[model samples]
Target: MATCAAPSESDAPGHPDRSRDDRWAASGAQLRALVDAFRSEPVTPARTLQFEHDVQIVVRELGRQVVPFRYNQVEPAAAVDQPRHARFEHETYTRVHAKTRQNVWTVFGQLVVRRIGDRPSQAGEPMLFPRAHRLGLVHGASPALAARACQLLAAAGANQQQILARLRADHGVGWGVKKWRPVSRAVSDEMGVYRHDAQVDQLRTWLAAAGASTGRHKPVVCVGRDGITLRLRMKRGSLYEVASTSTVRVYDRRGTRLGTVYLAYAPEPGRPAMRGALTAVIRDVLTRWEGPVPRWCDVTDTGDNETGYDDRVLRRMTHPRTGAALAWVRVVDYYHASERVWALANMLFGDNARAVGWAKTMLTWLLLPGGVNRVLHSAAAFRAARTLTRVQKKEYDRAYAYLRNRMSHIDYATYRRVGVPLGSGGTEAACKTVFIQRLKLRGMRWAKDGAQTILNLRVVFLSGIWDVVYGRVLAARPQPIMGGHVAAEPNELEIAA
Candidate 1:
């Protein structure tokens, strides 16, 4: 078996040039200083505060001093070799500046580097620093700090002010909303790339497992979809307009939610667009299955377009590679159907005790075997017996049409017996957890791209995949540059430090 060796003192930042013995002597001196400081003060709240302050000062000072040394150790030398391309001759980069100073914000506080810079022979090109560029330190903040900020905003659902406050309080890193906002936006903007990369990775892993014959029987998959309204600012007016966010939650046989995906856009994408979005989500989930393909169940409310789309678009969808159609079982949400029944009862017999009793009776009939037929017959009979007003007549007609249309999907008895869910409670709860809890705060109005970006991050965070997505986003960041050249590595350095 192969074993990995631990990093030595020379491999660590700030200690690269120092021998192990010298490092030990320095550590002893620092420990003694700390001990002497503690001995100089009694155990009081004021002394505790003083100690903390001193530690902060020492850490920041160390960071400032060591960052330059670390940068120099790995800085590309003058006239470095370059790869040859088909159309261009091989070239080398020359040192442009012996030393150039740049400041970067980091978890350890602001670190300044004054180091040698390199540049390509070509004119009008940018400078580069191999170590700093590799460390993702050429921008406003280090990639690590940007990633930390993204985590705070995405997972914590914190506003700019809250993120700033927490970073200062917990990490001793001071930053304003102005500095934090762009970092977050830059991270969120890569949502498309992150999502695509993740899906591809998942599919590749699944395919590998299946090829190795290590796949297990697939579990039952339940899909719940619903929509929630968002208040967004209007271009023409001071007031905001209502926009809808569609959400889909997938769960395994054991009722453990696998993931939740969301689509929130303005001007409401028509039925076709909405259906396409849903189809992509379903396909992505089903494609990663191993062994037997799982059965699917869609639990949703009785919206005309939503039901039609599921039946026509989602149920008919086939695997692009396997050509297997999804075995989808449709279900109308029990509560929504019951609400229609109650509304019919109230319209026919006012909102008194009689209406309540009639509604309860109809609901009971709706749940029993052959109950949909009985409920329809009873509703028709009640309408015939009572002389309804024009408005009440319209309500009666709507109730009859609603049940008649969804009669095929309302098999509550079999669903109850087989453990299939009858209601879209999961979807309802998802609306609150995925979107409302974060986006529906007071005075929160979002621009189109901003809303979509945050929604993407929110879903990724809620689905327990924020780390994966964020890592991809960090990896996809533009290559760092220094003094007029693309930084090339002589050998890999510890960028994480």
Candidate 2:
């Protein structure tokens, strides 16, 4: 098989780098021969096999020729400890034995990177190929390949095996699931770091802008918060229910969703941590708003878990650095409230013809002017008129408590007039899109870290900030450097495959 070779220092006089040109020309010639052979074969199963084989050969040769050119461009020149005509005496690089590292697979073919450096005991020891670090090239795959693998995983929602198949079929890159998994994890981990840094920068910029504002009137901002349960595999072989929160932001009109953010905890975060995560989401929204700080509205369901969300979470949010309170009016989701009313109606009327009729009338009153007052009056009258059974009384009491507890949040008429949203549908949909669609796939079980990392990528992609976030991620990665002593090679890097 054809293999890539680095450019040698020795060259014949007056020859115009014939070695490099000849390698390129030879690869080209072989590619042409493969094409010819493929075309000459008849349309049989054997012929199809021959064509595939020929294509692989051509790609291998092309990769062999191209890798060297790229490597040489960024490879450091031979080290010069001292020279007679040197301008400075600070030069310290010295030539040493070059060792062959593991081969990395790419779309083209297997790529061999030779590590050039000093002896183990030398001062500047174990010099590496600078281009490799610049490109984030790993022992098993190049950065480009790793990134491509991650993109596929994110976009296709494919498992490791499926991703490997798609890559080989679509891009001509071949690697097993074991190789792809770590690359995916590494890229996702980098993404997590990028997300944190981006949020910090955003907060700083928002603080600066807030400080400069002249306190002009701004439009109201509507935020919807909700949680979705994710099934996670426990280390002890049972399933665990983890709650992930989703937040959605919309402008004054609530017609177009501005953005959505998700906080997914695999092993389940504590209440304080969950609250902090939620606070971060609100902060992100404030940072992205163009106008001055606006009135805030939070629409959420009235489930037991979400009952105190307003007081416990939203009310507690403040500017991390400035300590300014972020106050928002809490609104119970209209649909959730309506569902309770429907249940009350069913309990009161049973299979009577008036059940649906009463439910519709109650729903209309709940949404009309003086709705909560009218609904409360009607409930009181109904309770006084009926000598209910114990079960019936219990249901009625429960329904009354639900409405009374959220009475402040049930003012649909005022909310409608003010253009505030009354539903948490945006948050619910966001939960489905950001987490359920990808992470909750069939037979999928994730480690805590792995799930969180993947969630980071999914959020960035769904929020339409993948490109920006990914660029930042690449920038945030520490540039690989040569170490003083001989670095211990990873098991995968020990052999060229």
Clashes of each: 8, 0
- The top-ranked prediction according to TM-score is 1
Model 1 lDDT tens row, 209-297: 43344223233345666666666667874444444445554434444445455554433545454465556766765665544565567
* Candidate 1's TM-score: 0.76
Compute the lDDT of residue 214 as modeled in candidate 1: 23
Worst 10 residues of 2 by lDDT: 81-90
**What TM-score do all the candidates reach, one by one?**
0.76, 0.74
Q: Which digits, one per residue and each the tens of the lDDT, describe model 2 over residues 130-188?
A: 33455566545676677677777776357667877777764566677667767777778
The whole-model C-alpha lDDT of candidate 2 against the native structure comes to 0.62
CA lDDT of every candidate: 0.62, 0.62
Lowest summed lDDT over 10 consecutive residues: which window, candidate 1?
1-10
